[model samples]
Target: MEYVEIARAESERGELVLRERRDENAPTVLELRANGVFVMDTLETSTEQALASAALALVDRPRAVVVGGLGLGFTMHEVLADHRVEKCAVVEIEPRLVDWMRDGTVPHGPALLADERVTVVVADIAVALAEAPPSSYDLVLLDVDNGPGYLVHRTNAALYREPFLRAARSVLRPGGALAVWSADQAPELRDTLAEVFGDAEAQSHDVVLQDREEAFWLYVARVPSDA
Candidate 1:
């Protein structure tokens, strides 16, 4: 495969190096740190799409949506694609990812980043959730790292905990849903969500693009409004 150096590696965290590869098929990403840790790439995004689609299926006439993680903007794109969505806010902890999308390093970056309906907030999503409007957003989609099974940043694990889940629940509108993407089915995560949301579920779906070699986990938790 022929490749061009569209963007070079840069360190956001202590030893984390992020690089973008522009090739004929698509411009993808590579993230590494002190160890040989890798994050994600462009070839696969079934979980991202599934997460967004699942939440969208539950919410109707959603005035806004909050998406955590800007990994290639696949989830953000899916949320914005919905005509019923009036506005969308995306919170990304990594500034480099936002910059990468801003400068068009990856495919469709500019279109997604500059979309009038999209508000890209460069901050930790947990912090953003602290003040995100109450009963404001109909959906909250998070794919910040490798999900509940694997995490890119250690602190992100809190996002899967009760306190953070309650915060996310607070920001969500009644009947709104929070969808988290995981690399593998997490029964523990399912239980955690059930404890926090009072109702939660986990579903597995196979991706046609992955040639059946891959499957995605969709964890949906609903925040019910008081009648």
Candidate 2:
């Protein structure tokens, strides 16, 4: 196996690194790391893509969507696939990650950034959600950290708390939905969402890697049209 460094930077949150690695029998893979924690790569993005699809499925006509994290742009790309989505805002804490995408460091980055309906916001997702007007978005998808159990940044833990969840709910219009991606099943997160949204469902998706099968989780909560 051979590894090559692509780019590295320091963000307000922590250290961010991008690299490419190639193996004898496998294709070259681009990986992203934040504060020495492994984030995501280009190997398999089914879970990220599923996050968008599953969330949109719950809404009738989702026009405005906000994605919490913009890792490799897979989630945003998937969100744009639905013609019903007229505006898509992606909030990323690290500006360097967005720069890498804009400069073509990530393979699928250019196309997603080029989309007219997409808006890239370089800011903390929590702040963005808090500042958003009430009932403004049709859907909100969160893929920032790994999950409640594992956090790339300690500060990100607040995002899964009751307060943030409530704030996220407040930004959703009636019948709008909020979706979260977790590297593992998070029962506590499900319960928290249930408390905030009145109901929450956890869906498991399986992705086959080179050596094993991994189960990723998605949590979806919707506001009733009457609410």
Candidate 3:
């Protein structure tokens, strides 16, 4: 296995790096790292794709969606795969990552961002959700950090707390849904989502990564139709 540095940028939060992974026997992969922490990779993105698919499936009208992170654009790409989705607003905190995607530093970045239904907003996702108008979107998918338990940044911990969760809820239209991806089971987050949205469910997705079977969790909650 070998890693070739593709691009690196220093952000206020930390250092962000894009690299190409070349394995002699396996296909090449692109990986993203933040502050030296492995963020995501192009290897198997079943979890990311599942995050978007499950949330969109729960909504009766998933025409407008908000994706909290733009790691490698896999989640965003999955979101756009649904023709029912007319708009996808992606909120990313690091400007350099966005620039890389736009300028082709991240190979699939340009093509993914070029989708007419896609809108990129370089801002803290928490702030973006807070400032958004009530009932602004039909679905909100958060893959910003691994989860509240495995945070890439300490500040992102707030994203799982009550206040920020409420903000995410407020931005959803009635009957809309909010889905959060976790690297591991976060029982507390599921409970919190239940409290905020009146009900929530957790789904486990078993995937094989690097020849190891791992389990990822998705927490989903939907606003009532009459709300």
Q: Which model scores highest in TM-score?
A: 3
Worst lDDT run of 10 residues, candidate 1, spans 27-36
lDDT of 2: 0.90
Give candidate 2 regions above 4 Å deviation: none
A best-first ranking of the candidates according to their TM-score comes to 3, 2, 1
lDDT of 1 at 109: 84
Query: Which lDDT tens digits does candidate 1 get at residues 1-227?
Result: 44333444445543434455555665544432322466655666666677788778977667788988877788888888889998899998767767877886665789887889999998989999997877778888888875787887777889998889989988888878888888888888889899988989887777665477677788889877551
**Candidate 2 residue pairs in backbone clash:** none
Q: lDDT tens digits, residues 1-227, model 2?
A: 89898999986677999999889898899998887778889987777777788888989989999999998998898999999999999999889899999998886788789999999998999999999999999999998986777888999899998999999999999999998888888999999999999999999877776668888888889999999
Tens digit of per-residue lDDT, candidate 3, span 81-150: 9989999999999998999999998888899999999999999998898899999999999999978888
TM-scores, one per candidate: 0.86, 0.95, 0.96
The window of 10 residues in a row where model 3 has the poorest summed lDDT is 46-55
Q: What is the Cα-based lDDT of residue 203 in candidate 3?
A: 91
Predictions in order: lDDT:
0.77, 0.90, 0.91
Backbone clashes in candidate 1 total 0
Give the candidate number with the greatest lDDT: 3
Ten contiguous residues with the weakest lDDT in model 2: 204-213
Error at 223, model 2, angstroms: 0.5
